[model samples]
Target: MTSPENAPASRGPVVWYAALAVVMLLGVVAVVAARSSSNTVSNKVATAQTSKVKTGSSSKALPQLMDGKADAAIGQIIPAVSGKTLDGDAITIGPDGTSKVVVFVAHWCPHCQAEVPKIVGHLKDSPMPVGVKLLTVSTNVVKERGNYPPKAWLDRVGWTAPVMADSTDNAAATAYGLTSFPYFVVADAEGKVVTRVTGEISMDTFDQLVKAAETGKAPS
Candidate 1:
């Protein structure tokens, strides 16, 4: 039997409770939004870090070669050479217990530019001897030279031979007696230098050199 004006006084506690619930709900919503924002930021940072790692791995700096004439000689035991490939894999020469026909080339030499493809084509048509391995050394790399980056040039020509990048000091080339561009060194299974040829050579001459290396005799 309360009067109409007194009804509001009875509902005061209920109105206060409803307002408190709304405030609590808004607080929960705000917290959820903040957490979502934090997660989005974290994901973006992780993605950027992953991209940086991939970029760092793909681009590697080329080395500089030392200035000097190679001292490699026939009948001499050549030292072992180790280096990385364009793909960043390690390669070691003369340690696999196999005869090798090593070709040394420079990116800027016109003769080498012509001779490399020739050698690659000839070898593809007529493979090396059973126990003989054909190896290529990319040496004397220079930024201002033709075929600036040797790896890209070799890829364009489809050079399938196992290639080793010489050190900044051109250690591999120096060890194998690099007297000139497009140098060929034939070595026996025990890593002994059997013979060497400088400048461009015919496929027939290359075959003779391989034969001489396998038989431990000079080509007549």
Candidate 2:
């Protein structure tokens, strides 16, 4: 009943509409697939980049040293703490049946900045006695502060000690009851604390503390 020219015109409109609908559907599906793929990739990246920190339980926190009187932490076992190094290598500092002289330092502290080089130089001149392990903890890190990246600062000072990178929550510091920068904890072979000292100390004093750890005796 329809004329030929009019029939063709009607068919043309219907065909064009169907083609446009197909194209729109395909575009919507492509966008959805792309968004899902992007989310999956982002989740994988976040998981792979996460840093881990592990700390052991402590019965009592170390008392803050005031005028050389805080020896409460002495005779207590040093907490078993484990964390990663600057290069992402795993390390643990605990009672490993070896004497340990652990020093905790913050990159921004002036005293720590002055102390590291002296320790490094001393170690270079006189290595620690056999069976004694010297460990360093990089803590209280602030990217906006001076000596921002502790690894670079330590490397520049020719530090050869194994470093334990602390977490953002200062977990290692808290586990050890850190009260100040340039903190020292001397633990004997059984992991019992022999003594603790803070602030910059003379290498002679440092040697004495190391001796205390070696002998399992608290310094006088």
Candidate 3:
């Protein structure tokens, strides 16, 4: 039998113990809920960013070429080479004494993946000059996208054109006065420059230029 005063004091401890247990359980639940909410928010943010890059807005793509005035000086010199092919030998730009090199490359460019194939097809079977040679060069801009292909990967891609390499700084790209990739230029036999084409072109353009070279006509 306990005294009346002592009884209340003993009951107080039991009450306090139950209250503490309830508080601890509530704390644990709150922590778990907060972590779950944070993870959900993070996942949503990641998905949105990826979507943004894929669905580029109207402002980000290459501007469509029209009858606007284009600076012809953009493509003045041939894009020089800084790397060899997959084999240890030096990658040759042209065999013909007067070579007409068509460089298919990009500036940290994903579009190059598509444009490169078309350029390759044209150079393989297009009507080039009898004494002219053609080539494709990849600017080392792929490192920016974190998807730079191995040198060998660029070589095997259905290209009959001899491929060359550029420095990460794109030194060869600068010589042609091009600030972008998939650039084109025609060099005369004596290494005199003909014309510099700055945008993506079709096989017809290559043929047109070859005809232009033969006729001494500047490419339109």
Local distance difference test scores for all models: 0.72, 0.83, 0.53
For model 2, how does the per-residue alpha-carbon lDDT over 137-215 read when each residue is reduced to its tens digit? 8988887777657877777888888888888888888888888989999999999999988899999999998899899
Highest-scoring model, lDDT: 2
Candidate 3 residue-pair clash tally: 2
lDDT of 3 by residue, 1-220 (tens): 8878767545778889999999999999999999999887542211110100111122122222223556444323333333454333355443135656556474346566666667666656664557767666666545336434534335545655555555555444544456555676666664445655656677777676666545445676
Clashing pairs in model 2, backbone N/Cα/C closer than 3 A: none
**Which residue pairs in model 1 clash with each other?**
64-168, 65-168, 66-169
Measured on C-alpha atoms, candidate 2 has an lDDT of 0.83
Clash count of each predicted structure: 3, 0, 2
Scanning candidate 3 in windows of ten residues, the lowest lDDT window is 47-56
lDDT of candidate 3? 0.53
Off by over 4 Å in 1: 1-72
Instruction: Please give the distance, in angstroms, between residue 109's alpha carbon in candidate 2 and its true position after superposition.
Output: 0.8
